[model samples]
Structures are given as C-alpha cells and as structure tokens.
Target: MLKFFRSIRQRLFKQKKFKNYILYAIGEILLVMIGILLALQVNNWNEHRKSKGTLKSTLKTISSDLKRDTIRAGYLIEIIELNQENSKAVIDRKVTIENFTTYPRTRSLVTIYQPFDIQTKGYDILKRISEQQENEKDSLFADLTQFYSLFIPNIQKSNERLEKVVIGNLEEFQEFPWFVDWSQGNTTEEMIAYFAISEDYRKKVAAYNVLAYGNHLQLIKGYKENAKHVLERIEKRLEED
Candidate 1:
C-alpha cells in the first residue's frame, strides 16, 4: 500500500503540476491522521472492556463476602440470644445449685462466644474498593458501610462484656461449697447446703448481673439490623436488571 501511494506521488510530481501535488500531499496527511485516530480508538475500546471486566469481578467477590458475613452474623445473634436467656434465668432467681447443669450450659455458651468477634474483612474489602477508586459513590459500597458501621462496634462491646463474665468474676462464683462440692457426686449434699442461700448467693447474682447479658442482647439486635441493611443493598444492586 505504501509503495503504491509512493508511485502515484512520484508520477504526479514528474507531471510538474505543483498545485495538484500540494493537494495530493494534503490528502495523504489527512488519511494518515484518520488512520492514527482509528487505531487509538480501538486501543481505548479494548482497555475499557478490560476495566469493566475487572470491576465486575471485584463486585462479585464483594457480594459473596457480604453473604458469608451475613450467615456468620446470624450465628452470633443466636448465641447471644442464648446467653441472654441464661442471664435472665439468673436474674429472675430461676437458676439454682440444684439444677447445677446451668453451669455447664453457661460454659458451652462461653465456648460459642469464643469463636465470635467483630470482624471487618467484608467491610475491609469494600474499603479497598473505595480506596482504589473502583466503586466510589456506588450504592453498594455506601450501603455496606452503613450496615457494618451500625453493628460492629456493638459486637465489640458485647464481646468485651462476655470476656469479663467468663474470666473476671466466674471463678469466685464457682468457689462456693454448694458448687464446688458437686464433683464428688454429692448432689444431695449440694442441695442441702443451698437450703439457706445467704448473702453469698446474692453476691454471685450481682456478678452475673453485669456480665455480658444485656450487652449480648444489644449485639444481637445490632447484628439483625446490619444483616437487614446488607440484604437490602444486595437486592437493590443485583436488581439492576
């Protein structure tokens, strides 16, 4: 193609037609500019396609992570509810050394509490998307932040209270003869000792009062709100159908 154009230019030059030669030169320059512009446009289109694909993948990953976080939030809420129920029993004078199985029940609740904590991995991903300027001002990111912002702090607070319950005051409660003397398979003696249930019993009840119960309930409520907001955002984003 270059050689063909060059030959035509050479023949026109030899004709001594200066005006026609200048017009031909201008036409060649215009064609070359058009070709460059077309090539650049193609390159830009490809780049945009790649960027869109990357953004879609990132959004999908974020959505999946949010769903997983939702499931975990539900589990935590359930455990918190159980803990609250146990605490209420103690508060109502319904818990007793006679039904000493409550101690093991409380221990099991603590075990569930152990695995639970306020995590921001899902939120961290959303922040990363925002930091990268990948999805700024998008409703998905905005709603995600809103949901997590509500619940995470309360969860942290509840976890702290749960820790205090298990480690700070529980040992003192277990030191009583009614509770400690149960290991010798002496339920009858333990029940007999609890007949009067004096000031010592009152003190233990006080410790249980402040430890992890109300806070856990607060966390459960917060988690439900968070999950609800998250689900709403996800439904809206995916509804772009």
Candidate 2:
C-alpha cells in the first residue's frame, strides 16, 4: 500500500502537476491518520477485553472464598451453640457437677477457646487488583474492601477477646479437682462438692460461654449476609458480560 501511494506521488510530481500533487499529499496524510486511529481503537478494545477477563476471574475466586467462609462459619456457629447449651445446662443444674468428668455433654463445657478460621487470600488478591487499577472505583470493590478489612477483622477481634476471657477464667480454675484426675487430687465426689461450693466460678464459666456463643452467632450472620451479597454482585457482573 505504501509503494502504491509512493508511485502515485512520483508520477504526479514528475508531471509537474504541483496543485494535484499537493492535494494528493494531503489525501495520503489523511489516510495514514485514519489507519493510525483504527489501530488505536482496536488496541483500546483489546485492553478493555483483557481487563474484563481479569475482573471476572477475580470475582470467581472471591465467590469461592466467600462460599468456604460461609460453610466454616456455619459449622463454628453450631459448635458455639452446642457449647452454650452445655454450659447453660451445667450452670442451671440440668447437668449436675457430678457428671462433669464422665458425661460427654458436660465434658464439652470445660473445653473452651475455639477460634474461627477466616480465609483472606481471595480478598488480598482483590485488594491488589484495586490498587493496580486505581481508576476503577466501583461500589462492589468498596463493599468488598469493607467486608474484608473492617467487618471480618471486627469479628476476629471479638473472637480473640472471647478466647482471652475463657483462657483467663480457665487458668484461675484449672487447679480445681474437677479439671484434674481422681488419682492426682480429690475423688469425683470431692470434685463435684468443690464445684458445688464455688458458685461464682461456675457462673463465670457460664457467662463466658454465653458471651462467646452470642458473638459467634452475630459474626456468622454478618459473614453469611456479606458473602451472599458479594456472590450476587459477582454473578450479576458476569451476567452483564
């Protein structure tokens, strides 16, 4: 094409048709400009397609991560509820202190400090994508950031506080005979009598268990809701594609 245009320009110039040659020159310049513009438009389209593909992939990963979180949260919530019920039974005398060592239900009350495992790798990838594409300030991105950075961390902190309280109370009460074996200290009857005598310690255990139970419930609710919202948004975005 360049050779064809060059041959025309040479012919026009050799024929001393300066007026036609100038007009042809301007026409050639316009054609070249049009070709450059078309190339640029195609490049922009390619880039946009690539970016959209990346976003879709990122959203898929985030959805999977959120799904895992919801499942784990559900399991933890069940455990928390069971722990609460067992502790309450012990406190209310439904499950007597005499059964604390031998009974399975009563045994769970003493085992505290279970922590929730939150997955953050997906969120971290999203965060990095947001940083790299600073111009793309979408609402979904903002919600994702808040969920991972603020809401999730807040739930984790609450769990940490609950664990601390449980640990502190357990440390104070570990020397009690009920926590130890019959061979090491008092007999089962003697341990039951000790627990029966210490109403305050029993109440503390019950209170901490209840606190943890409530916190876990609230965290699970928030997490599930957030996960649902994020998944819906991702699906919607993918649909738009």
Candidate 3:
C-alpha cells in the first residue's frame, strides 16, 4: 500500500504537478493521523472493558462479604436470645433448688452465654475498595459507609461490654472456680449453687441484654440494608451490560 501511494506521488512529482502533489501529500498525512486516532480509540475501549470486568469482580466479592456478615449477625442474634431466656429463668426464680434435686437444665445457663466474635471479612473488603481508584461514583459505596457507620461502633462497644460482664466480679463469686474449672464433671453442680439465688444470675443476664442482644439486632438491620443496596447495584450493572 505504501509503495503504491509512493509510485503515484513519484509520477505526479515528475509531471511537475507540485500543487496537486502537496494536496495529495496532505490528504495522506491526514489519513495516517486518522488511523492513529482510531487505533488509540480502540485501545481505550479495551482498557475500559478490562476495568469494568475488574469492577464487577470487586462487586461480587463485596456481595459475598456482606452475606458472611449477615450470617454472623444471625448467629449473634441466636446467642442473644438464648442468653435472654436463661437470664430470665434465673432472675425470675423459675428454676428452684428442688429442680436441682433432678438434673437441673438451668445449670447450663452460664455456659450458654457466648459472645459474638467480630467478623472482619466485610471490613477488609471495604478497606480494599477504599484504597482502589475505581467505582468512586457508585451509590453502593454510600450505602456501605452508612451501614458500617451504624453498626461497627455499636458492635465494638458490645464486645467491650461482653468482656466486662464475663470478667468483672467473676473471681469474687465462689462459683467462679467451678465455672472456670472444666476439669470436673460437677461443673453443673457449681453453677446451680451459684445461680440458685435470683439476684446475681439475673444481673449478669441483664448485662447480656444491655450489651449484645440489641447490638446484634442493629447489626442485622444494617446488614440487610447493605445487602439490599448491593443487590440493586448488581442488577443495575447487569442492566448496563
């Protein structure tokens, strides 16, 4: 192609058609510039396509992370409910010392008071997203921020309260040794002796209520909101595709 154009130019130049030759040369230069522009546009399109794929993968990761958080929230809710039930039983004196004459189901109340462990998966994804340069305009980011701001601090606070409730005055109670001592099968007996009184057991149960239960509920609510937003974003991206 280049040789063919050069041959035409040589013929024109030999005929001394300088004006037409210059016009042809200018047109040739224009064509080359246009080709370069088109090549650059295609390159840009490929880059944009790659970036979109990366963004979609990130969104999928975030979706999975949110689901994990939802599961954690549900688990925490379960623990809270169980704690509430046992605390009420111990506090109301529903389980009597006579109940201990039999195998007291109430004795395992202290053992059931498990705390929620902070889930870091969602937090890690969020941090990664923040560090990246892409997807700055996505509304999902706003939803994520709102969700984390709502629950993260509260969850942290609840964890602190759980530590306090489980540890504070734990050594002062005579049953603490038995509770901590898992070596003996008589652990249930120790629990029964300690919680037979309504006052102390109820207070610890109340602490669970004050700290974990409400926070778990709040976290679940936030997770749902975030999940909903994420689903919407996914749908929108699919539609755009």
Best candidate per lDDT, number? 2
lDDT of 1: 0.60
State candidate 2's TM-score.
Answer: 0.80
Ranking by lDDT: 2, 3, 1
**Number of the candidate with higher lDDT, 1 or 3:** 3
- Per-residue lDDT tens digits of candidate 3, residues 1-241? 9999999899999999999999999999999999999999999999888777766676666666666766776776665666667657666666666665443444544434354454556556666756875555766666666666666677676666666665654544544656555325465655566666657666765665555555645555566666666667766765776
Q: Pick by TM-score: which candidate is best?
A: 2
Sorting all predicted structures by TM-score, with the top scorer first, yields 2, 3, 1
**Per-residue alpha-carbon lDDT of candidate 2 for residues 96-155, written as tens digits (9 for 90 to 100):** 555555444443354466676678877778877788786346888788887787667777
Question: Residue 156 in model 1: shift from native, Å?
Answer: 4.7
- C-alpha RMSD for every candidate: 4.8, 3.5, 4.0
Compute the lDDT of residue 46 as modeled in candidate 2.
100
In order, candidate lDDTs are 0.60, 0.73, 0.64
TM-score quality measure for candidate 3: 0.71
